[model samples]
Target: MDITSPDNSYEIVIVGGGMVGASFAYALSQSFGGTCPSILVVEASAPLSDKFLQPSFDARSTALSFGSRQIFEALNLWQILEPQVSAIHEIHVSDKGRFGSTQLTREELSVEALGYVVENADLGAVLNEKLKVSNHIDFLIPASIQQISPTPGGMDLSISTESKRFNVSANLVVLADGGRSPICKQLGIEQSKESYQQHAIITNITFEEPHNNIAFERFTENGPLAVLPLREFEGENRCSLVWTTAERESENLMGLSESGLISNLQASFGNRLGKLTSIGEKFCFPLSLSIAKEQIRPGLVLLGNVAHTLHPVAGQGLNLALRDIDALVTILKTASENQQSFGSMQTLQTYVNSQKFDQQKVISFTDVLTKLFSSKKLARIATRKFGLLSLELIPAVRKRFAEQAMGLSRKF
Candidate 1:
């Protein structure tokens, strides 16, 4: 129980115990009950804090779909997060070209809300707190993997802390490491990394209106701009904005003073919601489309950001990751009940096949949407205009897109 010591071995080893890893661990613990399997989590930093404090309240946030929220509830972490979460009740999509736009309401779909937004730190804290209460899960705070090797029947990992080295062996090893995962590369799994010419500038802004649980997404020549609903204090309403633009423009925008930045935002975006009164500190991230060529290997499987990193055009990156987790957990449940080896090639193949369609759907959708919205070529521009017009005119197509945006395309 001492933070100074490390567990010697485990039946399952997870690398990168961030939100993604935490999700898998929580699910596995629940599905198998406390007596399930010996598990150890090797995280990038200490259990709670490395560079940031617990519940850091950092600028990063995610729009979790209703489906994903259910997954959290199944794992018992949602109760801890629900109090801090902000529900998205409505959404509007528009474009600035000849093409018009379409709007969607939760009422149209007969759903309580479109989605929920929660701070990244709050989500992480909830997962870690559950792990703390789980006697079956061993928390390796502030450790990194020094070596990973595949044996004939199992995988071996050597992890280290400042004071000592620890050896861990698992029948199955899951890579939940974030994008550009060293574990994936070390296993010689190929990845397709397509760098984009754009960057996303993310920040929180105080709007004149209360947002009223509405989320706005406007497509522009540069890229798509999204305003997500968020809550700061008990009585206040705010929106978390992720605006994608060309690299140069993003740099310029990040450098602007608070007032100047608000002015520019107001100009680019008309007063539909009223003026932007104030802005929060801005953060920027390079955009890219990354998908692993292989999703599984002998005694190893990849999930989460380690599996695929899509552009944030629709904010479904994490949702897609949760889907992967959902499918994998289902496969594992069946295999365990049938007394099958979880890391066997047969089990791995089943997990891979179950996820093939969903993964392809998300990657392809984001790729095509980004290219369509960011194009400035005359032909491409005209095509997007017509596409937008179609969306406005066709109720069925608009509903389909809206449902997809709400992360309801697949029932699971």
Candidate 2:
């Protein structure tokens, strides 16, 4: 093995620079009192200065729950990201060709807006921009981790960039490199995956009428469709669409012409937003429930999709991850203040324990919703109707449901 001298060592090192990982780095840096801990973030994809390739930082839109908004504001990133986001004043959820439907509005929840939708690429730009000026964070892009070894006091990592190879050691290694990361596999971190046999076709579609900042989540015969409102571009009413269907149907849909696909969308999602005028390019990806069986091991920890990948039914994937990030940052800041070994099993376990409940709750909720709403059985249909009705008519139930959708749990 060609082991060279260490390039540098850090108190903390994040293995990915996607949403969750990048946010954690910034949050941790901002929370420090005086001297911030030395932090390093390694990303395989090219930096924003070049061509970025991380799927998590793509053209697809991500819904930021109200709680996620708070996290950003607290980190002082909201100002940079707010311009690219569209506020979701209301969420209309219904079963296609069914009688019962529910509408959750910001007014009813007593919030300015339920959530905000921002393009992944735009958010990435903001994050990368911050990284460029971050004094405490050493951000490296177009780099990959070849191997990781647990050390007595910390962890040693071998990374490759271009034709160069180097090593770096850190007290902790945060694995936020997305689901199905080979590094996690190499570490023998078991993952339990439940394939949904579904694929989501995501795109942006312009509608005839203004979205009026209203989002729609309609459960159809094939699957669920979400139309999240977007900021107007040149006075055009736009919305980001996530249409989930069977894998086979998704393949067929991808081949359809723009007008054909728009027709299919209009058919599945009613005329609530008037006619579909135009659509951007469509992209499809499989859906599943994949959770890391073990989140922490000695000097290593998992974050973002690496820890859990959920169905995007409730737009809870990123929201839940952000919440977990918040908890991890809280724990790490306290550990730093106390001069504790942040990589110790005890400190890492504290993070795992704190994030365990929220992770499970959100995962179970999304998984159940995926199965329940995807079914066409009479009993399931009736249950779904009841679910929507209860969510709307009952005050207490509505509040709880709203809290879940807005990512406001007890932890917050």
Candidate 3:
């Protein structure tokens, strides 16, 4: 749909309308409070009625830390999305073939829940609905950015739409498409990537017993596996499973029959919730650590997975990106109030500086968890046991771990 008038330009343009990009649009519009700059969102694909149509919002589930819930509350979107989520009241962590384990409860953290797990489809529906009702956002869907050229005052984007080809200029361009964005490559931005030689199998599973809203993180020789609580389906105890294993192993498991897979899963993860009676669709993809070295430049910025894609071991990837969006909104609002160039290196650098610590800390934490838990050596096992016990024995250590995992330690 050719909605934009000829010669019309925007003050800011968001290249992706995925979760992070949509959240940034909403947060920025809310920050301006009806007196906002002209904003445009160029989305390559139409808003999919079936969430699985989009890779970013699919059959998988996401764990929203308490801090993320608050951020949603600030934007007034939490109430609409809350009922679709299953609260994570407690977290149980263990190591296979080991003796040490630890537990984190909401009571210890003084929160109603440690986190909430919601289907990717549910979240995508909420975000799409919110963006639809927003008057300040001009979203162009089924469009792609053919090329990008940096201008003195702003950036120029050559966008290809179904109807016609057009060019738009914006004072600021936010690249939140994803980690593997071709737009980044067009702009000459380079990302340094490190592959883990592992893959995660994601699916929704049903168990015989009640999960009691407890999330489980089990370390195995293959990789870190997580089972997050999900809302019950048809009176069955449901959970979202992320099982990490070597690439070849993942391929073999994905080809097995449902019964065979369930049997194997039960072996790795004891029958904590009794038998895994059934499972929904399955998805598997190779895991890696991709970090864009340069995230900001004059008239441009990178957000979300485009900036950094982390291992799923900690469920901190999206949570960390939301935090980055929050910081960018704060910086942009302040810059607007001061009449400074929001896309200037000075302004963008401020955001980079403010979020550096939080980003690095989360990245380091997840990386360490992957390397430590992925190990099968005696020393690594002993260290992991000590780590688990420390979390159990020391309230302070537990508190810090919980706070970080809950996305509390880096609140904007």
Q: Residue 410 in candidate 2 has what lDDT?
A: 57
lDDT tens digits, residues 120-174, model 3?
8888877766666778888777677788788999899898888889889989999
TM-score of 1: 0.94
Candidate 3 runs further than 4 Å off: 1-7, 48-53
Q: Compare candidates 1 and 3 on lDDT and give the better one.
A: 3
lDDT of 3 at 210: 89
Q: Which stretches of candidate 1 lie over 4 Å from their true place?
A: 1-4, 47-58, 97-99, 232-235
Model-by-model lDDT, in order?
Answer: 0.80, 0.87, 0.88
The C-alpha TM-scores of every prediction are 0.94, 0.96, 0.97
The pairs that clash in candidate 3 are none
* TM-score of model number 3: 0.97
How many clashes does the backbone of model 1 have? 2
Residue-pair clashes per candidate = 2, 0, 0
Ranking by TM-score: 3, 2, 1
- Report the Cα RMSD per candidate: 2.2, 2.8, 1.7
